[model samples]
Structure formats: structure tokens, C-alpha cells
Target: MGGTFDPIHNGHLVAASEVADEFSLDEVVFVPTGQPWQKDEVDVSPAEDRYLMTVIATASNPRFHVSRADIDRKGPTYTIDTLRDLREAYGPDTDLYFITGADALEKILSWKDADEIFALAHFVGVTRPGYELSAAHLPADTVSLVQVPAMAISSTDCRARVAQGKPVWYLVPDGVVQYIAKRSLYR
Candidate 1:
């Protein structure tokens, strides 16, 4: 699963778990975008902070792992590059699944190397709160739309809450809350 993962909230964890269970996936690697090209309009937390938050959030899950490929790589992050790097690392035989929210999947055509995306991995679009999931427009063979338990929490909301001096306790992992406080992120 690839995302900015600004704070790596519970919604992300639920989606990844639901998909992993439904698809019988061996493992789910969380790839936090280094420099999200699309989100460049807004100020994003440092790459290292986002990466560490992701690691803290996924630390307890045996099947969950964090990859710094996007953070380690210089320049703006494109979805194609992340998928290609994962494919290269995992090799040809291993079936790769690129898990993302339904909203992100809707913009697939506008992405760089759109056609080549499917060649690298199977795209799994998980239901996200407030986003209507419709795969009717997408190629059925390439994209699989699955419904996961809905959680209203989002990294954007979490950040706002922290900025307002409100609690984000259960919305994110305990370690994430501590890490954010320690780093004075979103303040």
C-alpha cells in the first residue's frame, strides 16, 4: 500500500488488513511517499517524520512492513516509480498488489505511465470514508474494488486536530501520537 501516510492513521491500517485478509496476500508493505507531487500545494511533514510514523504504526503487525523506497529516492514521487521499484525488488514471480483508496484509483488515468501501472501489480481499491467507490469505469481485469470497514479518520483530520490542540489518541497508534508530540509536528 502506497500513500503519503502523513500520520498513518487507523483507517489505513484497517484497509490494509482487510485487503490482506481478503486477497490472501503474503504481506503488506506500507510505502510512504517522499515528496508527493500532487500534494505539493500544501506543506507536508518531513519525509523522515512521515517514514518514522509509518514504521511506528505498522511495527506490531507481523505481516506489515515499512519501506523507505520513496523517501530514499530523490525528487518528486510518482506512483509508477514506486510500483516499478517494488516490482524490481520482489522480482517477476511474486504477485504484487498496489493497494490504494477508491478516490486515488479514480485518478489512475492521469497518473504517469498509467498503462504500465497494471503491468507491475494488481491494483486494489479499498473503500474510504466519504469517497464513493465505483469501478465501473476502470478495467475490471486491472482493478479490484473491495469494501473494508469504514473509519472516518484521515491523516488530514488528524493533523488538524493536533494543530488545534485536540486529541488524536485512538485515531492513530499510541506511538504515532508520541512521535508527533516529540517532533512537535502539525503544531
Candidate 2:
């Protein structure tokens, strides 16, 4: 699963879990973007912070792992690049599934190297709250639309909660809650 994963909330974990189970994937790697091209206008927390939080959130899950390929790439993150990197690392024999939110999947065609993306890996578009999932625009053989456990939780909301000095205990993991408090992120 690839995302900015600004704080690595429950929704992310749930989506990854669902996709892994549905696809019978050996492992689900969470790739946090180094510089989220789409959200460049807004302030994103440090890449290290986001990476560590992702690690913390997925630490206990044996099937879940965090990858720093995007964070360490040192450039604007594009989905194609991510897929390519993982493909190269895992080799040609392995099947790679690019898991993303339904909203992002809607814009897949607009992304650079759209054709190459589909050729590289299968895409899984997981539904999130308020996002209408439609595979009409995607290739039937390349994309799969799935409804994960409905989670209204968003990283943006979690950041806002911290900024407002509000509690975000259950919305995020225990370690994340503590990390946010210790680092005074979004304050």
C-alpha cells in the first residue's frame, strides 16, 4: 500500500489488511511518500517522522512491513516510480499489487506513465469514507475495487486534532499518539 501516511492511522492498517487477505498477498509493504506531489501546497511533517510513525503503526503486524524507498528517493513521489522500484527489488516472478485509496485510483489515468503502471503491477482501489469507487475509468484486468471496513479517519483530521490540542488517542496507534505528544507535531 502506498500513501503519504502522514501519521499512519487505523484506516490505513485496515485497508492494507483487507487487501492482503483478499489477494492472499505474502506481505503488504506500506510506502510513505517522501514528498507528496499532490499535497505540496500544504505543510507535511518531516519524512523521518512520517516513516517512523508508519513503522510504529505496522510494527506489531507480522504481515505488514514499512518501506522507505519513497522517503529515501529524494524527489517528488510518483506512483509509477514506486511500482517500478518495488518491482525491481522483488524481481519479475513476484506479483505486485499497488494498493491505494479509491480517490487516488480515480486519478490514475492522469498520472505520468499510466500505461507502464498497469503493466508493472495490479492496482487495488480500496474504498474510504466519502470516496465513491468506480472502476469504469480503469482497465478491468488491471484494477480491482474493494470495500474495506469503513473508516472515516483521515490523517488530515488527525493533524488538525493535534493542532487544536484535542485528544487523538484511539484514532491513531498508542505509539503514534505518544510520538505526536512527544514531538509536538502539528502544534
Candidate 3:
């Protein structure tokens, strides 16, 4: 399971947990992307902050862990490269699952080394409102949909809520929200 995970919100946790539970996964290693490719269109919270928040958010879950592979790579975090490195690191015997959102699946064809990514690990797509998985350009038959609570609260929305002095309690883990506040992030 991997993403830029700018602030590790509730939606990400729920979706990842649902997938892991459904598949009876051993553990869900949350991988944070270093330099996200889509960052050209949007600003992310600092990588260190995002990584720290993820660590705080998933602390209670014994099945959840964080991977700094992409962050350590220190360049544009390519999904294929992460998958490849994880594949090697975890060894051939380990079953690897790559989790992402439905909108991403819709545009999976455009990713660098898209075909190899599908060949590498099982893919799980999480859908929220305004995004649906159609039969269009989905990678072969490797991608499967896992339905969880469609959290409308995105990290961006939560940040805006914080900036506006509105409550962000329901958007992310309490610890994460507090960390964001303590750091004066998204201000």
C-alpha cells in the first residue's frame, strides 16, 4: 500500500485496512512517495512531516507499518521503482499488494512503466464519491476494487478546515490532527 500520503487521513487508513482485511493480508506497509509526480499540480506537506504523521496515525495497528523506500530514494518517486525495490527487499516468497484510488486506476495507463507495475504486484483500487472504476484502461485483470467508507474529507480539505479554524477531528486520526496543529502545518 503506497501513496504520497501528505497527511495520512482517515480515508487512507480505512481504505487500506479494508483491503488488508478483505485479503487477509499479513501486513500493510504504508509507503510514502518522496517527490510525487503529481506534485507539479499541487503542493504537498513536507515529506518528513507526512512521514511522521503516518507513523503517528498507524501506531496502534500491529498490522500496519511504514516504509521510507521512496523517501530514501531522494528523487521523483516512481511507483514501479518502489514496487521493484520492495519486491527485492521482501523477497520472492512475499505476496505484495499495491493499493491506490479509483481515479488513479482510470489513468494507470499513463504511468511510467505501467505494464510492469501490473506484472509485479496485485493492485487494489479504493473508490470514493465522484470517482468510479470503469472498464476503461484498467491494467489487465490485476486490479480489483475494495469498497470502504467513502470519506469525503481529503487531506486538502482537512488542511483548509484547519486553516479556517474549523474542526478537523473527523478527517484524520486524533494524534495526526494534533501533530499538524503542533507543527502549525497547513496554516
Candidate 4:
């Protein structure tokens, strides 16, 4: 699973958990992007902050882990590069699945090295609130559409809540809530 995860939330955890269960995945590694190219217009939180929040969010799950591959890489983060790095780390035979929100999956064709991305890993498009889960436009063989519990929560919303001095409890993990407060993020 790859996302900016500015303040890793419960929705993200739920989606990962559901996907892991449905696919019988041995582990789910949450990879936070270093500098999201597609979201350049937005003032994203520091990569270290996002990475740490992700770590706090997934720390309790034995099957969950965090990676710094994207953060460690220089320049704009792209899905293709992330997939390639994972492929190298896991070896040639290990089946790699790139889990992402359905909305993001819809824009897969526009991503850098789009075609090559499919070769690196199978794509899993999980359901997100307000986003339709459809594989009509994607390669049927390399993509799988899974309907996860609809999670209306979003990082944008969480950030807004924090900036507005509103509580973000339950929207994100407890550790993340504390981390955001401790770091004074999104203020």
C-alpha cells in the first residue's frame, strides 16, 4: 500500500486489514511517498513526519510494516519506481501487489512508466468513499478491484480538522493524533 499518509488514519488501517484478509497476504507494507508528484500543488507535510505517522499507525499489526524506500529516494516519487524497488527487495519470484485507492488507480495510466508498472506488480484497487471501483479501463489480468469498507475519512479532512482546532480522534490512529499534536503538524 502506498500513500502520502500525512497523518496515517484508521481508514487506511481498515483498508489494509481487509485487503490482507481477502488476499491472504503474509504482510502489508505501508510505503509513504517522499514527494508526491501528483500532489505537488498541495503543501504536503514533511516526509519524515508522514513516515513516522505511518509507523505509529501500523505498529500494532504484526503483519504490518513501514518502508522508507520512497522517502529515501530523491526527486518526485512515482509509483513505478516504488514498485521497482519493492521488486528488487523481494526478489523475482515473490508476488507483489500494489494496493491503492480506486481513485488513484483510475489515474494509473497517467503515472510515469505506466505500462511497466503492471509488469512489476499486480494492482489492487480498494474502494474509497465517492470513488467507484471498476476495472473496465484497466488491464483485467493485472488489476483486481476489491470492495473494502467505505471510508469517508481522508488526510485532507484530518489536516483541516487539526488546523481548525477540531478533534481528529477516531478519524486517525491514536498514536497519529498524539504525533500530530506533539509535532504541531498541519497548523
Candidate 5:
């Protein structure tokens, strides 16, 4: 699962858990972006902060792990590079799945090396609130659409809540809440 994971919320965890269970995945590695090219207009939090928050959010799950592949890579973070790196690490024969929200999956064709991405890993598009899960625009063979429980929570909302001095208790993991407060993020 690849995302910016600015604060790594419960919605993310739930989605990963649901996908892992449905697909019988051995592990779910959360890869935080170093610099999100698509989100360049916004002032993203530091990569280290995002990575740490992801670590805190997924630490309890034995099957979940954090990777610094995207954070360690220089320049803009792209899905193709992430898949390629994982392919190299796990070997060419390993079956890798690129899990992402439906909204992001809709924009897959616009991503860098879009066609090649499908060759690297299979894509799993999880349903998100306000986004329809459809593979009409994607290759049917390489993509799978899953309907996860509705989670309206979003990183943007979490950041806004924090900036407005509102509590985000259950929106994200408890450790993430504490880490955000400790780091003074999204202030």
C-alpha cells in the first residue's frame, strides 16, 4: 500500500486490513512518499515525519511493515518506481499487489510509465467514500476492485482538525495522535 500517510489514520489501517484478509496477503508494507508529485501544490509534511507516523500506525500489526523505499529515493515519488523497487527486492517471480484508493486508481493512466506499472504488479483498488470503485477505465486482467467498509476519514481532515485545535482521537491511531502532538505537525 502506497500513500503519503501524512498522519496514517485508522481508515488506512482498516483498508489494509480488509484487503489483506480478502486477498490472503502475507504482508502489507506501507510506503510513504518522499515528495508526492501529484500533491506538489500543497505543503506536505516532512518525509521523515510521515514515515514515522506510518510506522506508529502499523507497528502493532505483525503482518504490516513500513518501507523507506519511496522516502529514500530522490525526486518525485511515482507508483511505477515503487513497484519496480519492490519487484527488485522481492524478486521477479513474486506476485506483488499495488493497493490504492479508488480515487488514486482512477488516475493511474496519468501516472508516469502507466503501462509499465501494470507489468510490475497487480493493482487493487479499494473503495473509499465519495469515490466509485470501477475498473471500466483500467485493464480488467491486472486490476481488482474491492469494497471496503466506508471510512470517511481523510488525512486532509485530520490535518485540519489538528490545525484547528480539535481532537482527532479515533480518526487516526492513538500512537499517531501522540506522535503528531509531540512533533507539532500540521500546526
Candidate 6:
């Protein structure tokens, strides 16, 4: 469940919870990306703010918790590194699952050290509308599919709607929306 989590939203929670429930996972970790390789060309919201919002968004769910591994890492965050660190922290036998957007999974071949990631833990892809991932090109066979409802809403969309003074209440949790407003995240 590692992501930039620019601001945690319903899609993320729903997909993660669905996966946890489906697989009976012990806990779901919400990892905030330190510095996303994909976002190297643009400015991202600060890690501290993203982490705080993630904490606030998941506070009500006992099954969900935030991980600071990615945030604390000094270099560009890699999924393999994050997964390795998590495996070490949770012990070797822990049944860990990494949830990601299906679109990202489609581009796994381009990721660095992608082969090692397949051996790390299970990958749960959250399918949404439009972009469908090709299972044929998976980084590894460890990739498991869990088709959660397409939450058409994305962080970028939410941010844009917020910047335009549009109502974002329906796209994310109310508390999370409030946190964004209080912090002026998109504005």
C-alpha cells in the first residue's frame, strides 16, 4: 500500500480494505513515498504533510497503520527497498501484500530492480476505470489481482477540483477533505 498519498482518499482506503478483507491480512500498511521517481519533474506536497494526512485518514481504522520507512529513506524511493524494509520489520514469515494502482503495475518493467520485488511479497493491483493492466507483462507472477470498483477519483483530480473551488466531499472522506482545506493543500 505504498504510494505518494499526496492526500489519502476513499479510493485508497476502499481498495486497501477490500484487499485486506479478501485475503484476511493481519494489517495494511499505508506507506508514504519519500520522493516518487515518477514525480521527479514536478513538485510534490511535503512528506510531513502527506504523512500527517495519511495518519489522520487512517486513524479510525484499526486494521490500517502508517509506515515511515519510505519517508525516512534518504534517496529516491524504490518499491523493492520499501518491501525489503517492511519484510525485515515484520519478520520473514509475515504475509505482506503491497497494494498499488493497476496503471502502475502496467509499467513494472521500467521499475528498477523489479524482479526482486516479486520475491518480496504479494502484489495487489486495485483496478479502476479506463486503464486496464496487462497481466501478461507483470513484473512477476507474484502479482495478484483484486478488482476493486473503479474509483474514478484520483489525487490529481481531487487537487484540481479543490483548486477550482469544487466540492470534493464525494470523492474522499470528509475528515480528509477537511484536513486538506485546513492545510490549503490544493489551493
How does candidate 5 fare on TM-score? Answer: 0.98
* Total backbone collisions, model 3: 0
lDDT per residue for candidate 6 within 1-187, as digits (tens), equals 9888887788999999899989999899999999888888967899998999899888998989999999999988989889989988999889878899888887776788878788888888889877777787774458888888778878888888888999989688788888888888888
Of the pair 2 and 3, which is ahead by lDDT? 2
Candidate 3 residue-wise lDDT, 81-183, digit = tens: 9999899999999988899888777777888998888889988888877786784567557888888887775777887888899988878999988998899
Model 5 lDDT, residue 135, Cα: 83
List the candidates' TM-scores in order.
0.98, 0.98, 0.95, 0.97, 0.98, 0.95
lDDT tens digits by residue: candidate 4, 97-136: 9999988998999998998889888899888888876678
Which residues of candidate 5, in runs, are more than 4 Å off? Answer: none
lDDT of 3 at 109: 81
What are the Cα lDDT values of the candidates? Answer: 0.92, 0.92, 0.85, 0.91, 0.92, 0.86
List candidate 6 segments past 4 Å from native: none
Output the TM-score of candidate 6.
Answer: 0.95
Q: How would you order the candidates by lDDT, starting with the best?
A: 1, 5, 2, 4, 6, 3
User: What does candidate 1's lDDT look like per residue over 1-187, in tens digits?
Assistant: 9999888999999999999999999999999998888888999999999999999999999999999999999998888899889888899899999999998999888899888888888899998878997788788898999898979888999999999999999999999999999999999
